[model samples]
Target: MTTQQDIPGRTVYIVSDGTGITAEALARSVLSQFNLTFSRIHIPFVDTLDKVRQAKDQIQAEREKTGQLPIVFSTLVIPELVTELRKADALHLDVIQTFVEPLRAELGISPKEEIGLSHQNMESLEYKKRIEAINFTLEHDDGQSNRNLEDADVILVGVSRSGKTPTSLYLAMQYGLKVANYPLIPEDFERGHMPKALQPYKNKLFGLTIQPERLAEVRNERRPNSRYAALDNCRYEISEAEGMMNLENIRYLSSTSKSIEEIATAILSNLRSY
Candidate 1:
């Protein structure tokens, strides 16, 4: 019955012998289940016994200062370092050991105790795919080129400042999706049709619209007091773009109250449906 109100804050130490990205990600994913606030301290590159000792000292000092056993989530592959860390006065959670031991037993093989092995393989085909997808997304951004719409895994269409650019980049970099994005301008509305380049590849198109107030606010920050950033203009563009999307039967979502991650995830879910 540990309600959020009972704990004002809890300290979490993310200790890793490498970049610490994996440890931090694991800690955050677990912490998100609870509603309590957390103060995170990342201790990366804890590769040596001296470094582990230093990390142990820091964890002990924090526990003494806060009068609470700080939660330590570590991805230390070195047995000696893990042993030293376990002696510290804290709730030590071994991220690698927990999973690796089970895997070793199940597979009957000793796991390689190497650091950064997952990401260190830069010459990997998966890594190359990500790089190529990123490059394709950059080249096709904002309808910059019409030659490769067919090559895009997904194409995002939105009015000005509705988060078309960032979402496309995220899809490309994270999912290895060759994403292209196009802006829906006033001229396109006046023409009363979809862009000729996008007509054939309509299935790949995803529409994004935002609330007028939010769009206006975003535009105003970039170009203040102009007609382009006006509330009326934003409202008009959103309405027209949404109407066109509906008429064309394209899948669309509002980015008004969504973060980039939420928006990207929803887009991916929509893609899977097709």
Candidate 2:
């Protein structure tokens, strides 16, 4: 294979027209265009043409070190500022034109158009509401479980210490999924079905399982050197738990060697896909 190397001394400067973080964040996301690490400077909203002129001079100074400099404006909306930036010609520059430019060009829509908030955004808000409702139920379960479970977006079950609580909280706090979890005790494992309490909500339920060694390590954190934290106990619990899930024909995800964020996202995405 022929290997090619990169050019040296190449750079791109992204100067923001305003101090708003949103504008800076968007510009940061687009920095991959440079094919090199970039430098950023955020100029704040101002009232005077002299200040706008000065910002252009700063852009020119940054441009002197780079092959190209792209200036970004965020609701700066000042015509005088725009005029000054357009006239500065040391290097080729680009401004994010507007949200509607792509829409009009791609879909033949007019300049005064609105796309509304994306469906993902609306779904996110609903997900947050559901998670909040679920958290309230978990904190208050006090033998009064699942009065609000009917309202849960998802329910997770696994043996005790299999990361049930943290995983459920992570799902709620991050993806906004209302998650309730009930543990499967040994007696229930012997009978090989989910907790009768969960049977009523079977369709909404999901399961998590982990390797015995990992489960032992995790339980040790909460109870140092106790029999509950012993590897033998962990192995028995995990094997019985997996057997119970298999006998009941309940599909489950392995939580071993995965971070909480990864597990929660995979679970939510899997549920949505299903």
- Please, what is the whole-model Cα lDDT of each candidate in the order they appear? 0.90, 0.65
Best by lDDT: 1
Error of 1 at 166 (Å): 0.8
Positional deviation of residue 169's Cα in model 2 after best superposition, in angstroms: 3.0
For model 1, residues 1-274, the per-residue Cα lDDT tens digits are: 3445536667899999998898898899999997778899999999899999999999999878877788999999978889999888999999999999999999999988876676735789988999999999999999899877788999999897999999999999889999999999999999977788899999999999999999999999999999999999999999999999999999999998898989999999988988
lDDT of 2 at 11: 38
On a 0 to 100 scale, what is the lDDT of residue 217 in model 1? 97
RMSD of 1: 2.9
Cα RMSD to native, each candidate? 2.9, 6.9
| Consecutive 10-residue window with the lowest summed lDDT within model 1 | 1-10
Candidate 1: clashing pairs of residues: none
Residue 122 lDDT in model 2?
Answer: 34
Candidate with best TM-score: 1
Cα shift from native, residue 30, model 1 (Å): 3.8
Quote the lDDT for 228 in model 2: 84
lDDT of 2 by residue, 100-167 (tens): 46866998865532222222353576756855755664762322375667777777778777767777
